[model samples]
Target chain A: MSTTLEPTDRTRIRRGRNRAVADRTELHALLADALVAHLGVTVGDHPVVLPTAFAVDADGPDEGGTLYVHGSVGARWLQEAGDATVCVTVTELDGLVAGRSAFHHSMNYRSAVVIGRARVVTDPAERQHALDLIVDHMIPGRSATLRPSTRKELAATAVLAVPLHEASMKARAGGPVDEPEDVAAGIWGGHLPLTRVVGAPVVDHQTPAEVAVPDDVRARALHRA
Target chain B: MSTTLEPTDRTRIRRGRNRAVADRTELHALLADALVAHLGVTVGDHPVVLPTAFAVDADGPDEGGTLYVHGSVGARWLQEAGDATVCVTVTELDGLVAGRSAFHHSMNYRSAVVIGRARVVTDPAERQHALDLIVDHMIPGRSATLRPSTRKELAATAVLAVPLHEASMKARAGGPVDEPEDVAAGIWGGHLPLTRVVGAPVVDHQTPAEVAVPDDVRARALHRA
Candidate 1:
């Protein structure tokens, strides 16, 4: 498939043939696993990429086809993304895959970048759903536990819906790039792995004493630790 | 102090006078927390930012103050950073600190971006030390675990030294911003905390039964999670 940006000649690290990827399931998995994404917005010629905690809002029956991203209506950058076309990139590094030779050293990583135009959602009815998506993005089932959004609180948030089909994910995982000659020379090589873990959750000092951790939250805590 | 970049300007994220910071200790901590950074280089205004795994290399006793970064010499980007004026950024998002007001929605984050010209270190002895800095950057004691680099490997690695004085770190930690008009809205807001955790060490399935997890690696694993 032809890319909208054509891998601009100078920006292409490897050849288009080397870096181009075509896979949907792989892309979805990457989007689901990442908790944050670096958003790049360009005004004039300069581009500023800011990392933001984000969750993917999949298309639903009642919703138009748009990837929902909710952030503080007060945030300058978030407001920009909500109003214009932007690039969202999610990346995860799996490990340091060592090669036997200098040229062979490499990393195992998965990265996905999506480009789309978004419009701020102002409808009162849709605003609550957007907040629900944001809440669900963090703790899957916590939306039900928390009180629903009030009319005033809903107005304070800005939700943007960006179409998600125009996206791509690229990944390289496995052993290092080792030249046969280097392997024979017997230089030690392999992968130094990496993983994300969550420590024990610290309860909020202001949380009411009567409330206990919900089942889903407890399960997530166990997974994180 | 006024920043060259304006706070609302699109060309860059201009530092607010109160938000801008210049401190070596803060810079160092941000760098220590980050394992990968986007090294920005401008080749005659054709700017490019590439992600690379890096480790800190300390300038020796004689050098009043400089920071060293280690990477593959074969990687043109690393070599370029060694000789050119560049900006290296390290950022960590501790939590999404929400406040009672829309304007106050903020985050607990620490970020350091060093803008400077990197000096190349070519001495054989200094090169070895630089390599050690890179190794120890990942695992403090593991540098001693592996055999020393061969002459060829050392030649292929690039070590760049940059003065720390020119660098700065920007940090923000607090609750949300609520307009006085919205003070009585009674919306719940605080922090949606975040952290990087290490999980159970998934030892290589092929590892021999005799080798056990090293103490330094164990400490790091427990500390981050």
Candidate 2:
């Protein structure tokens, strides 16, 4: 796979062109860090955007790679997404840029958008792998410890694969950019960094007392902090 | 306005009906707490989803209320969005639910979807008000402290307003819900609560030496922590 992202006509960045990032590595990193992605699909004449858990396979069987998103088989949007053009977006808010003037106030964020025609996963082996990737994406080393999924469970889930060939990323960081006159006003101008903090685990009430928090869970909480 | 959200055919919750929220107050609270919104619009045959800062006015001049999202006036998507049906989604991921079985794993999140035809804000006063709300939404009491937007700055920004009448919200909270058989296996099952933390201000290097961090910035950083 190429190290740089090749933006197509649809993926080209027009506005805020200065913030556009062509590095595929940055796109992969942003996807790995974000917990949720919003999937957009056209339903009839209008569009619908819903949040769902997503995972990516950098060397999967697709044009560039494969991006996987799963939903209940009964979900109407999931059924409508099959063989249809879709857009998936993941964003991380980094900070609040407080400029000397309101016109310059903005946000520090990293956002990625992927556009492709989604194909429903039909092969049992590939579907299983995609499901495991989704699970492990949320908690590292999680799917390895779980038992094999039952047939009923497998039948109840639907996985959609979107080729990562057409993807774009944009990010903004650091302090606010205020005008020279505003800077001369001697007012406060800066940014407050935002972060996602993971707290202690809240054990399920039904879990047996002998069952302890897994090593992966403990490590993730501390690593994210 | 009605106290409860009236979900239209497009806004109805078809899957995970248990997590659907019907109260208007809950929708307002979710919108207020969220900092970014994903806007989905159909450009030609495909859909495009992008993240942008958003604000809501509960008593604004719209059907139920008004949702404001701004972008560069030269943006292609913003130009296409005028008088077009669009979907706006805001999501807050609360926790990672670690179920004993991979099939049952999910994330606890609060998500709201609004579907409507966006109208470009042409009125000068309303556009100015919307811009102020967007700035204050990021930092409370921020817009009041800054100078009024210059005429050139106002001309360079485009604001789109979507009515909140056809909106729906769904949220999942607490621990994982696993099958009885998986629970009997005596494996760990719980959730790790996630939170957004704000760090100390990073003042711009160009700011005058005498300038100090403003009270609003300090208060928001501490409050969000």
Candidate 3:
């Protein structure tokens, strides 16, 4: 839990204005909390960002060493991006900061940026582990209840693993910081916090009514609600 | 509100799998619902994605013709990416679809992808309007209550506008779609809906207790909570 953040050549934050959190522990926590990531890959000379499901392997205390992103084998981006340097970013918008003046308005957010080369996970054992980790990452303990993947189904999926060594986290929280004059002007200034709630589970219509909802599904449904 | 999607040369979905949405109205709704965007910009030959606050100008029915992004003038990504083709993506994760088998497990999300070139907004009046649009975008009726931006504050901020003509939306919702054999296995299958809640406001400590929270703030606090 005492991991430090070492800024790499590309992971450094150049703006440095209102960047509140940059520690490795905080980065790991943010990565664990977010379920989806916006992955950036080069399409010719321009950059394209796609929202995809991602999971980080649990190796340390809230620290996932490698990030695993999966897609269909027919996905053009995955097929074209062979061992290419890419970026994976996960962001959580916690609140909206309202300042006394229009210019100072900002958001309270936690973001993690990982910059590295992604290699296709070819080994069957590691690929299986990555798939399970992804399922459990979204819903803890849900993977154990599900059936394993068939060889044909596994062949249709493509898994990519990116090392988390060159990564950085940045965050901002708390109330608005208005200028001294604006504060004295007595304009209302505060922050409206935002939280994510998991709603009740909706069972599939095709499922039989006799089957009861599993504990893992119910637990996550009520968690942070 | 019946605008169909026009597949541009750049914004077309090449992988055509599980892309449940393509209507322009749906794309506009997703863009309006999301507050933060992952902006992809190039630095030398590599792509970097940064989480930033953005606002879409409302012109048609939930159709914002231009995407406006503002940041500090000193930000490196904004500076280096002068008139470069950029992709701005906004995504909302609605649910986690858990199938009976690991292979069919997926996520329910609404994502909008815009591919275009961003130009720095230089007109003073347009820049002022863009700043106010961003403030009101985060919180409705917020800009009218706060004081206007000073000349110095306006100068420090750089606003970029990217046309939203070349854009597309993709979404997936409802329960998991499992195979027939997997459905017969009787393993649990459902979706856990994720929602965003607005928590109570936290006022600045330096502010006097007599200053009351504005109605706009209180209204949004209870909205969609």
Query: How far in Å is the alpha carbon of B80 misplaced in model 1?
Result: 12
TM-score of chain A of each: 0.83, 0.98, 0.94
After superposition, which runs of candidate 2 have C-alpha atoms over 4 Å from their true positions?
A: none
Give me candidate 1's interface root-mean-square deviation.
5.4
Ranked candidates (TM-score, high to low): 2, 3, 1
- Candidate 3 chain B, which ten residues in sequence have the lowest lDDT sum? B57-66
**Pairs clashing within candidate 3:** none
How high is each candidate's TM-score? 0.66, 0.99, 0.95
lDDT of 2 by residue, B102-221 (tens): 988999999999999999999999999999999999999888888999999999999999999999999999998889888888888999999998999889888877877889898788
User: Model 1 over residues B1-225: C-alpha lDDT tens digits?
Assistant: 122212223223353335565555555667777766555554333334455556664345322255566665665556556567665555676655444433344556776555556778888887677666665665556566555567777776777776544455567765445554444444444455567654434444333455565565565566562
Give the worst 10-residue stretch by lDDT in candidate 1 chain B.
Answer: B1-10
Of candidate 1 chain A, the 10-residue stretch with the lowest lDDT total is: A1-10
Which has the better DockQ: candidate 1, or candidate 3? 3
| Of 1 and 2, the candidate ranking higher by DockQ | 2
Per-residue accuracy of model 3 over A32-151 as CA lDDT, tens digit each: 889889999888879989998888874611233788989989887787555998888899889999888887788899898888888888989888888888888888897788777888
- Fill in the DockQ of model 2: 0.85
Top-TM-score candidate index: 2
